[model samples]
Target: MPATPAQPSFALPVPVATTVAPPDLTDSTLLDVDPDAQMSLGAVALDSRSDVVYATVELPDGARRELRLDALRPTGDERLPLVVFLPGGAFLRCNKAMALEARRHVAESGFVVASVEYRVTPDGATFHDSVRDVRAALAYLRSYADDFGIDAGAVALWGESAGGHVAALTGVTDGLPEFSDAAVLQGQVRAVIDAYGSSELSAIADDFDEAARLHYRHRATQFSAYLGRPGAPFPEIPDAVRAADPAAYATASVPPFLFLHGSEDMLVSPSQTQHVHQALRAAGADSTRYVLKGANHGDVGFLGHPGTGLPWTSAAAMGVITGFLHRRLDATER
Candidate 1:
């Protein structure tokens, strides 16, 4: 016998909670209750699907990269409007799951929320590639609208920082042939929510204060990399920089836009939002701008988390956002 096989030992399982006594049903009586009384109900049950591959990009070197999105929707048969969210990582990475709590809140409010992932600097993708990826996501969502329980015609774009910039570009450049691909189906964008995103790439550095400017040099490098000109001086390629600016493409036909920016944001200037807002207004487009006082870059103030102990809570920020979406998407009619 091979030296008696060692006995396997197992640790005792820990109880998840203290055991409680069961209610006694024997003496229980059925009592009449008023069914029409006012009551409070919590959030609606939500179903989430993650890592949904929306598109695949084939690089010049024959390498294929898959772009994905995470979707959150209510558990029901009713089709709802779609809100596509883009997470900001300075155009270097696409962190699609960021601010999931806020996204869930939006989904709970009767919209299908999708957080999309696009190619970034690491993939050697330029700003044009990011725009294309977002458009591809919109097309894919529209193609599978029935499966996802989404209304493809009433889609919106929402993003923060770099994502915000991309969302704005995608919104304003809706039907432009240069920014669109014939192979990709395009849908009408009803609204856009841009949070602390730069509208003019070349003016970003100038908007920062002296102290913040020191750190922005690194950001300039990142922008250069996103432009497909790594190690090149930022804003040196004037035409490329202009092409990436959303304000440069603003027109009257663009959909309604809601711009949110932090007054204390040192990374991306608040002026960025103001400039685009003014441009849209000048172009006779509907646009709204909000400056959150005492809020910094990527601030929890934007999310309205109670844990931040700020005077304004999630209710305040999300109220404005959801209200805007409701009006723009005409959710009440649906």
Candidate 2:
């Protein structure tokens, strides 16, 4: 008799918990309810008929997080391109939905998708810590590439909102511990998709007095908890914010870049993408940009998820992302 298939040791794939509860629709939106923090990195979970490997991990201090990678097998022993996704919500929010969405588009593009969930705020962690998690997740995948049949050398970094900021930062800052640390994340990945994220707080600080501005997702109200200084006053956090903003760190050494931004996004300025676009162009890096008309900051969600058919919904994002990933990854594979 043929060998029996091994049972997947992890939970079933989860449908993204859309924020349908309609809690406080105030200026400061609440953090989305979190998913289970299971630390089973490299563990295989079977979903439907497919299997996905979870790159579950715990930081040095034992804070747990997970990176979900597709359990895909290539035709031969050939390896496949992979991307580590970091979802964005200022500095305070995001989850596996962002990762799953990336997988949906990139899977057929000859890429393995890994969605990462970083440690949330008020844990006494900083913006830097979250970024570190991304680096660590990438490294973890590389260390065990063979187990998952992944091509460590071909990994891409992708993200939305704050995730986009981190993705671009990874692109801009080369030779940093995130890339250079052989112990965790691979030192080099071929590409990046910085989807509509901004690092500069000053851009949003323009109309600082408006109470409406404080209520959005991009502002990182949790981040403000540490800053203490008001946005109207333009606190010293710019130096910190600038440091955190990937655009300020753009250099010639960054990777192939694709930027997507909404023309009418109320949360982050479209100029945010422009900044990175110009920086990448000036650096002579391979780059491209898409300006989604009338789309909000959650543009990807509007495009990719089902039932977004009316206008800017999740289903629409799916089509946009599918085309984007195919075009870029196709060129990349060549």
Candidate 3:
């Protein structure tokens, strides 16, 4: 009874509005603006969807694995051209989220960009499996074009390093029976952007400069792993290696290609791209090659990241890439 006597005397403090009101200026000249003045409407807001399963594969051990892709698109109702991106991890892993900011940049440029995941060496996957996975991803996208706001007919392949090789090979071998299966739908690629990707695997080592040769000698093991021929003689060129070369399949009907390689690349060697470019040119295919000066393999130079030596190299590389893309895959009406 004694404790309850004064317990109810406390009062709660009332809330106060800390916001300040704007001064009224009904006829202020500051509000006046030129209606026709050049102004930025603002960048298109991008909508991203991750882990979109594009295909399923049955492994040799009777297990099933689901392949996925990450799509970044502008928020709108209209369908847009799709750029399927294949990332590089020496064919040992496929990280769909790699170079995400770059992909977003592409998305903002009025295209739907999808970074696809393919079976890698860890999954007992070979070059054939990677090719199949990429084709399967294309098929899946085409099949679900409406759902993803994709223009099924207007699609392109953009891959880096190993993925670049796959994209090149896939682009050149379109409609070929050996590279595709009936389970997946087939679609034509409008253009291909090969970024420092290898073309002839066997010749890669030989193509490297003295510095590259010393730095990337381990690439032989990577090649062996990708070909599913581990411990194979590094010097001997296998039939699988030849078949996996994009240059081997270069033809007049192949899609237009834009090859970007760094002059300083040591891992895959710029010569890898040169061989493919030469083959495509010889076959009467439309091909363009640019060997970036002072850039290295998968370094900030090749990927347009901030780095030393010619800071504009990154912007220049991206400008060239985007320009090529716009020419090949025109912006779809949105």
Candidate 4:
């Protein structure tokens, strides 16, 4: 007889009791629900076959946003690990197109993948809104873990560019009272993937100035807007800029991090990733940095496009991600 493969073990998620039903996406009224409504907390709409759910997440101040989560467990496994992906668009908006990457990750890694929508700075928002939104989504996922068959204890945060900064902030600042939400989360992030995210705002300020002198700069870049003053440089807004810089907040308690960047990334310099990685290691946190040679910002090469024929591939990047998560999250499961 052929040998049977060993089954993966997962910690059973705590069941949630609620009378709140899945909201109708078309109803604008459901757009903003009360977070205090226990029955409606983390309310979401779902597709049974795909195991994908769209959660109507309520912010601390009662504003609302929708979060998409795709549950992709291997056949016969009752539950699987979770990986939350934050999309990059500077801080202006969360790109909707990243859903394709989410699906690809599910197919390749068999992990529950979540793509979050955070309020961008262009909507009169700031770094606070983005960070709070990501935290709220994290709480919602854990609060309703049973409904999604997610291993609440095994979770990772992955992001690119601005999204990467948000993920880094959320993970590095875990357990701070101000950052917590209504959902009583029981676990911590096991790993983080930061792909070419700006680690320091001061560096961005310099980048903006150089772009301006070259006559190729937009009147208001995302970083300036995120500082609450569009077209202003970081030197003029030192305090808020410092508050939003992930490198400034790096601590020993941060979860293991994998930093990826293209050596030639002109938008968010590869140096930003390198600096943060150094900070993490200095704080005694586990970290790794990989630079894709001659890759530009947001290019296909960063995602490991084989057609680009770059020396580095997205396959290589994804491989490092899964390997890190497996080592971190799977080890915890065992």
- Which candidate achieves the best TM-score against the true structure? 1
Output the better candidate (1/2) by lDDT: 1
Model 1 ranges with Cα > 4 A deviation: 1-42, 214-220, 300-313, 331-334
lDDT of 3 by residue, 169-239 (tens): 88998878888887766656889999889887766655544543433334346567677777564455468
Model with the higher lDDT, candidate 1 or 4: 1
lDDT of each: 0.73, 0.54, 0.71, 0.60
What's the candidate order when arranged by decreasing TM-score? 1, 3, 4, 2
By summed lDDT, the worst window of 10 consecutive residues in model 3 runs over: 1-10
Compared with the true structure, what per-residue lDDT tens digits does model 4 show for residues 1-334?
A: 1112122133211111112122222211111212122111112223222423445555546776565544444444456677888877667667544534333444345566777677776456677667766777777778778876778888899888788888887778776655555454634688898877886766542333343323313333457777666777555667867777777778887888988765445556556777778888888888887766545554433333322222222444456667777887774555
Clashing pairs in 3: none
Candidate 1 TM-score versus the reference: 0.81
TM-score, per-candidate, Cα-based: 0.81, 0.66, 0.80, 0.72
TM value for model 3: 0.80
Q: Global lDDT for candidate 3?
A: 0.71
Please identify model 4 stretches exceeding 4 Å from their true place: 1-76, 182-187, 205-220, 300-313, 332-334
Residues 62-142, candidate 1, lDDT per residue (tens digit)?
A: 899889999999999898999999988778778887767677778888899999998888788888888989999999999
Candidate 2 is scored at a TM of: 0.66
